[model samples]
Target: MDMDGGWCSLEEIGPLSKLRRLTLHGLEDVSASSLAETARISSKEHLEYLELHWSSSGCMELRDEIEKQQQQEVVEEVLEKLCPPPRIHELHIKGYFGRTLPNWMMVVEACACKSLSILCLAYLPCCTKLADGLCRLPSLERLVIADAPAIKSIGSEFQASSSSSTVDGGVTESTSAAFPNLKYLSLVGLCEWEDWEWEEQTVDVTAGAMAMHALERLEIMKGKLSCLPPGLANNKRHALRELNLVELSNLTSVENFPSIVELIVCDCPKLKRISGLSRLHKIGIGRCPSVEVLQGVPSLHSIELEDGTIERLPGYLPCVNPKFLKLTCSKELHGSIISGSSSEWEKISHITKVVIYDIEDSDEG
Candidate 1:
């Protein structure tokens, strides 16, 4: 209930009708759309959770394009009259500068929020796609699209389409498997997201083309992604474990994720390869500087490297066989790994436990 500035008495929520949860901020000063359908909010059938905000000065401080398409057609008619009923299960739209989004979020198989299991669309400085049959949500499980800088491209209809079922009596053709129980997906600050078309294929079972099959966790931050999407970095449909990449300026390579265990990379300035993850255990690379590969991990345990502009001690650490190694270098790679006869101290002497901090005695310099 954060109906900021203008427009009130919008039918006073039409007697709330047992509104379970709702938050409406500014809503770009909704002027009409029948005053937002008199707040009937899809007949509030036990509305589960919903938040629609608009007002980062409404439409990211518009730069006039016919007044930002008349404020995106008045916030797309107040989000098509704030439709959410049908047991909404958590929906969040923030600072929406709509450019086509509400038509009740597609999902048709007779959808009206098939108990939506969490959907977030943030900042949205003029949405451009995303929200097309959401792979026919079958109890969606956490999807977050942040900042949304006018999304650039994400094709293959974002997974699963071509449908038809009438078995044993005619037509037959199946490919259903898109976010089929999504576990977690976060795409942040999509600053001109560079194409994603899902290519990695190896017949993702059940009649091909699966997507996000019970995905474990995936995070893409500040995108400009130059790859990934062969149905998800292909390693032949393995329920991903965890893969977090940040500041992907032009992702170079994060090879086939064959059931990744954990990998967190930051400031990916043309990340140069982190080869095939074969059930990798742990990794945290920061300020990546053309990483030179950590080939087919053999179940590594842990490694957290933070390069404060390296000067050594990162030849991919003797092809990691982690047992725990923190190291935040660049005090000349912490004096070349404490000079234990440098070779980066025998490439972390079969690492069993090593922690070194350098960059001017770390305090996050």
Candidate 2:
């Protein structure tokens, strides 16, 4: 039912105990009682997916600071009462303007939604950072955080606190294991995010705690992430296979993907070096002018470059033996590559297939 002005109350949905999925929109007018009654319904246990969104119109034209603050408080209260029942496998919260999330989204033990696997949080413009408990969920496999402009860091709060029972050989009892079961993660459009702090106690993979042990693919876009999470980058046994970094301005180097098979770097102007990717098979670089070398990547078979400045090939090119090579360069660079006198010609001559395009052609075509 649409949550527009007084159309349906939570009391009406109380008997739908078997609900498997639900989307509630136009939450601006929903009262705190309506939301509380909705959460109290028995159907919460059967809900597998839930999406909550507030109306854009309700928050768009407000110019009064006091009135806006009052509205924010009401929104927060309504959201607090709208908590989804435990065991939900998927949840999406969008356009929430509250400075903090409700307890249901962050309290791990109390909510006990151990079956929760996929969580997507978007357009949360006021939340400074993710809820600490979100990273400690036992079954969370996919997490997406997007468009949170105030978030500046992801720190120890993202990890499970150390437990009291001491284990053998100097390991902590609880061992702050964060995202232990996560396989896919994406951080997008967090314009203010700058730091992803590494909690050494939780991230030290060699200490026998498997942190982010199940991650396979990671995508970061439109953020200030200068480097990867140290726990993820340093873990040699991590299962990551695909890594994509797009529009990260401060990132200078790409390193330590020991088993990654696919790598994509785009629009990172400060990027310079890529090393220690031993199992990579495909590589794509675009709009990164400072990147100069790619080494220790012997398994690379496909390479694509767009608007890059490197004139020579990798020092280990004889071992790379790429099956496909594509380059889109400036007119001068394109001329130099095709010229028999340029060293770039000899380096890529052995490739079985090569595709070339000038910068203008690439853009126009």
Candidate 3:
């Protein structure tokens, strides 16, 4: 229902016992206290999903005003009330801007959301407590945290205590454990980070150990990741199939991905080498001026290079066994393609097919 600038109480919506989905948008007058109450009192036995979007400018002001202990008490009361004996399966919150993650989040994590499989939070401000609380959800299968500007580290206070388990000889325990069932994770637009190093420690040993073993896909875009988390480099599962790294300007190398089938690197101008991908099937490279090699990838089937200028192909190019190759370049660099001998040409010809589309002709036509 359209409830913009209207006064409504949680009791008004609580009797939706069979409601499977609920959406609240453009709520200008609903206080955080009331919203929290609505979530707490609403019958969640059949509620599988809840979406709340507060886009009014005044909501921003409300966030600033609600930080008092008394206001927080109202939120706590609502959360305590909404703690379902059995949690819903999915929860999505957008445009949430409180300084700290609400306490009900912890309630959802600890008990109310035992069956939760997916949780996504977008456009949140930086808060470690929120991150910590999210890690407490035990049944999470897919976790996505996007456009959170203030978060610099992944481990928050809610990290589970370390456990003793070994996978492929890699240390597989952390003090904090969240997302135990997660199979896919995507983190995008985390801009406040200049680097991912939170300690003088050699690598994030703890964070790496907590990754869900079933994880198969990872995508990190436009974050301040100067280097990838060490856990990704050391994880043993060959289940990882796809990786996309976009606009991470500080990334200089890719030293992981043993079973990865597809790799896409775009807008990373400073990248110099791709040395770690040993089983890549498809490679797409774009806007990288300094890349010098596409080596160590044995199963590569397709390659696309766009707006990139490299002096020479990697020494391993002569050994590549790909089925499809597409390279687009400007007129000034067209001569480079003609001059480079087909040291790898025999291998290219042996492949199933090859199609080279020249962009210059398209521009001229």
Candidate 3 lDDT score relative to the true structure: 0.62
Arranged by TM-score, best first: 2, 3, 1
Question: What C-alpha lDDT do the candidate models reach, one value each?
Answer: 0.79, 0.76, 0.62
Task: In model 1, state the lDDT of residue 61.
Answer: 63
Residue 112 accuracy (lDDT) in model 1: 65
lDDT string for model 1 (1-365, tens) is 35434445657866879978878877678777787888888888998998988785645566787887877888798888888887889999888777878877754455568888999988877788887687677788999999888889988876755365767758565646676788899999989999997664464354234667678899999979877766676655567789899998998888878788999999987888888788889989998878888888898898898878867766878876889999887777787668788776897889889988886778666
Span of 10 residues, lowest total lDDT, candidate 3: 197-206
Which lDDT tens digits does candidate 3 get at residues 7-71? 45555666657777666664333555556556443455787776665442443345465444444
Misplaced by over 4 Å in model 3 are: 1-9, 32-35, 38-43, 59-85, 106-110, 126-130, 156-178, 195-210, 308-319, 334-353, 359-365
| lDDT score of residue 218 within candidate 1 | 90
By lDDT, the better pick of 2 and 3 is: 2
Candidate 3: Cα lDDT at 190: 78
Better of 1 and 3 by lDDT: 1
Best by lDDT: 1
List of clashing residue pairs for candidate 2 = 17-43, 163-174
Residue 365 of model 1 has an lDDT of: 60
- Per-residue lDDT tens digits of candidate 2, residues 101-137? 8776666673466788999999987787688777667
- Alpha carbon lDDT of residue 19, candidate 3? 71
Which residue pairs does candidate 3 place in steric collision? Answer: 40-82, 87-112, 135-178, 159-176, 160-175, 160-176, 160-177, 208-231
